[model samples]
Target: MGLRTRPIGFGYFKTKFNDKVLQDEQDVGTCELLQDSKVRIIISQEPEKSNLLRLEEAPLIKRIELLFHMEHSSIPMSLEVDVSDTIGKLKERIQSIESIPVNRLVLSFLGNELNNRSTIHECGLHHQTHIEVSIRASPPAAASTASGSNAGSKKLKLLVLPRCGTKKIPVEVNASDNVGELRKQLPILQEKLRFSLPSNGYFFIHKQSVMDDKRSFRWHHVNQGDTIEIFNGWVTRGS
Candidate 1:
């Protein structure tokens, strides 16, 4: 038993070297607080039970064919529409298949103009595209060589003046009628002026000149109480 020597203590190796330098300074302060904070790790996406690989395909409404082009006509109006309609419903379907007068047309495309509340896919149009039709020019015969004519069962009170909301309305009309027959008296003057007339057709202006919906408010010399002015689309002039 002479070789049994026991000795391993300097306060137990200085308390295990101060608990291994306080656990290596708490593992270098948790690796410098995960290298200075913002440590986001996330990883959680588990949602695909596979109902045929999570099926969800149903979105295809895109119809466009357009071509219109008729300035002098050589035939170009194809119109398949539905890129969400609305250049005033493609001018009421080109005024019902080309009798033409959705306020004298005037569509246009790459050369601009297209704003009847815009849409045909917001004017990007697509498919055949070509557009441009223009028509509007038709009021001038030098006021039908004036003679101050006026007798188509005489009526003429007028005083309309409406670009929006009420400013004045009056309206009696007749004196040989024909300002496009006052659009059949616009639904009895929109129920005695409660408003809402222009369904894509309105134009009159008087003294500042523009009338001529085929003439006759005494050939637009208009009289009676005077002051016509309606206006709402369809009035274009520029070289």
Candidate 2:
């Protein structure tokens, strides 16, 4: 190679170009190289590290322990409802948490059964307050028979039997109406008869027993102005 002046490869030769053009090309090439390097770096990172940053933040939670003063008559043992829960929801939750039947459970906030579909605040419930829950057992056969007879007199207005020499007043009610609704309308009747509505009382509509005790038979489709017998043995004056 030194003896003969043979033409070398193009790589050995140097060509001159405009300074502005050369600088622009170099800048463009540098920008492309930087972009490619950045992409490679990102691809080489651990996939788990990217996923760890995207996890959602955990929510703040607070727990409260509540002691439900349950009576021998009540089946629900404990009530640990959330502060924001309603009475209805609390009832359901209590039933679920205690493994108790909902039908056999009745919740009393303070001294009264939770009515009006109110919340814990509406029922005057406070943290660490004692909530009394009572259970009502099913009446015996003999008691139910006596209750039927007593209720029958109140509905039929006919005193088939006599007790204490007091005349039994008969109340004529619709077959579809609830016995409780009739009791509300006859406040004086409640006092005069000195009887309380049973929690599990049923209405005998056309010789058929309707188990719904919340509303009177008047709300259902039955014979209009039909007489409904109300068994008053479930609750007593002092109970």
Candidate 3:
């Protein structure tokens, strides 16, 4: 084989070779074209499953004790749940044991609803610690009116407005809920509004009477639409 470069015309160079040489060149060019053809690459997604596993390597994976308060029942039960799991799953567990449906569930922790579509860790639950739950029960078929049941023993919808920049909270109250029971929700209120209520020397008043630890809402004749006043440990006429 011989290789040569020769000029043909117009200062634009061209090369003329022998037939055998030209054929060899064409074969080489064809080989290059074949080499340049598109090639396919196959990748697997199995590693992505591993990455998903690693993403959960956080402090949110821990075991915690949860307490369930069955509606209308004074007895409470305890269960173990992982902070990594959603509270929705815990509700499922409760439904399995208590025969209550998850959809009808009303769960609260530190007086806050657990139905926020968040994980236990995200909601600040901790490992090996106990939390409480209370089920929302259907009202008795015979109960009626704002004073539906005795001693507010039945549930009534009520609004609680703290005398601050705080917003009003509409909550279901039990006829059994007394002044002390209402005060227990102060921690939740402080957490939500980032403010504090007077720790001492304060009292809650409904109408003319000062609410005491011994009486329920029904004792004060507090109806559904009534608003109780938070006073500085005392009450006066029109106070």
Candidate 4:
């Protein structure tokens, strides 16, 4: 007679760990400790067969290096900082070196301005990457003076007086007025004095023979008593 055989059932099982083990447990074939501190149980119908399996290894972590570029066009121009530096800290460093105001300065990476609180790494700055730093000139005394002079020069004042023949009619004119406008006003004098105004001629402003077409004269600079002498053609009568 052949020996009687029984089919073995194979299956996976899971369980939790505690201070006590179940006394009535009968179906469990094996147990494993998982990475999460939980217990795993395996079962098989054959009591002699081992059902335990090993856990897979975890992946390794990679380390990355960071780099950044710094640029500035003002005095004490060049600066190099870590990719971890904050924008606010950079502004403070710049302020210490140059007279430029921190508020007026702007920091940008790859042509984009960085937020005040933004870190260098947040702005896509990488190791060895170059960044452009633009520094704007603040409203200093020199800048204000220059702007004031420009505004003053724009105010219209008599640069040249309109003359009638050799009689010098003493007409008030705008220094801002072009030589062509002056020529138009002196049409009678131009005809009487045989002084046919050249289409392209020069005007004497502040003893300088500035060409009329160049637009060099500022009407605001000319005072009430300023004299503008118009030359006929290219030759001066004395020359």
List candidate 3 stretches off by more than 4 Å.
Answer: 1-152, 164-166, 234-239
- Candidate 4 per-residue lDDT, tens place, 5-48, comes to 22335533333345323222333333233356543243444432
Judged by whole-model lDDT over C-alpha atoms, candidate 1 comes out at: 0.67
- lDDT for position 123 in model 4: 68
Once fitted onto the true fold, the runs of candidate 1 whose alpha carbons sit more than 4 angstroms away are 1-58, 61-88, 92-103, 111-135, 139-155, 158-173, 176-239
Candidate 2 at 212: error in angstroms? 41
lDDT of 1 by residue, 20-121 (tens): 312222444543444444422222233223322323353556896888888878889797878987898888888887787787788888898898998888
User: All models: lDDT?
Assistant: 0.67, 0.47, 0.62, 0.50
lDDT of 3 by residue, 16-57 (tens): 222222222354454343545542322332323433464457
Name the better of 1 and 4 by lDDT: 1
Q: Which candidate leads in lDDT?
A: 1
- Per-residue error for 177 in candidate 4, Å, reads 39
Error of 2 at 81 (Å): 2.2
- Candidate 4, residue 131: how far the Cα is off, in Å: 1.2
By summed lDDT, the worst window of 10 consecutive residues in model 4 runs over 47-56
Model 2, residue 229: what's the lDDT? 50
If ranked by lDDT, best first, what sequence of candidates would result? 1, 3, 4, 2
